[model samples]
Target: MLGAGLLPLGVLLFGALTDRLDANPIEHITHSTGKWAIRLLLLSLAVRPAQRWLGWSWALPLRRTLGLLAFTYACLHFLTWLVLDQFFDWEAILEDVAERRYITMGFAAFLCLVPLAITSTRSWIRRLGRRWISLHRLVYAAAVFAVIHYLWQVKADWLPPAIHAAILAALLAARFRFRTRPVSVAQSPGGS
Candidate 1:
């Protein structure tokens, strides 16, 4: 509910404040939206580790919401670039997608996110069952693409993107290492 409400409100607020937003208003909006999308995507991915290690089952419900929010922000980022920045110029947008490495990487990430978002519903979960897990695994690829997109866009000062990429690598490593590790029984102070 908050995601749905805040999205439109954000658009409206950005639209209203566009004049005073920044020197490159569209670029500012695009970067801001993309950043939020990547952040939410990382947060969504963290939910599983949080649940497993901290045993915070309650956080499970928020995973879907976070994933959806990531998709929402990604859409906003794409639209801001296509409509606002390019003025709906399909030819120019196509050229950019074809020529710009960062744009291509970003587009790939956005495209991968689409199916995951679509299949996040309860109905899809029920319909796909165990297969749903494999389908949603695309998020890993999306994260990689997102990191590449950010890295490719930076002309200099690779520090920020490198940090984000390192965090993503650590998160993914945690998932792989802990995913199948057996939970051993804790021995009581008194031997059984």
Candidate 2:
């Protein structure tokens, strides 16, 4: 699981070292990291559905790892944009987040992820108790913002973001359907 999560970063590094990232290396890096971040985030969201529908119980444990990996890629993506593209210009960064809808969406998504990542530890989980679950629900909002971010950023192409949005819709729909499912009397609490 760790190896799988690190593979994209390794490949990105290899590309940089080999001079294979093309002329706009920063653009390539930013896009690559953002793509991996969203892909991993979606994969993490899929884990619960896979467990419930396909009975893949082994996948249940992977949710946290995948989410953290997604966060890692997201951080890299943000860093590439901040350090390489914007050259640490806070004024411009704030301006972009304020003026650009896509940048706003992506920044919102990153903000949603921050607390979730910070509270992912065992000690934090114990400290937060039930509140932890509620807080982590921000991941859904984060995913939504990320999809919007990707969709709005595309200049001419719509296929990629469209597909991502469709997948996200399906996943959220499945989750709602699962929650609303009627339990048989025998399956209800304290039923004989």
- TM-score for each predicted model, relative to the true structure: 0.86, 0.97
- Kindly list the per-residue Cα lDDT of model 1 for residues 97-182, writing each as its tens digit: 99999999999999999999999989999999999999999999999999899999988899988988998998899899886676
**Model 2, 98: alpha-carbon shift in Å?**
0.3
For model 2, residues 20-101, the per-residue Cα lDDT tens digits are 9979999999988998899999999999999998999999889999999999999999999999999999999999999999
Most TM-score-accurate candidate:
2
Mind sharing the TM-score for model 2? 0.97
In model 1, pairs of residues that clash are: none
Worst 10 residues of 2 by lDDT: 183-192
**C-alpha lDDT of residue 53 in model 1:** 84
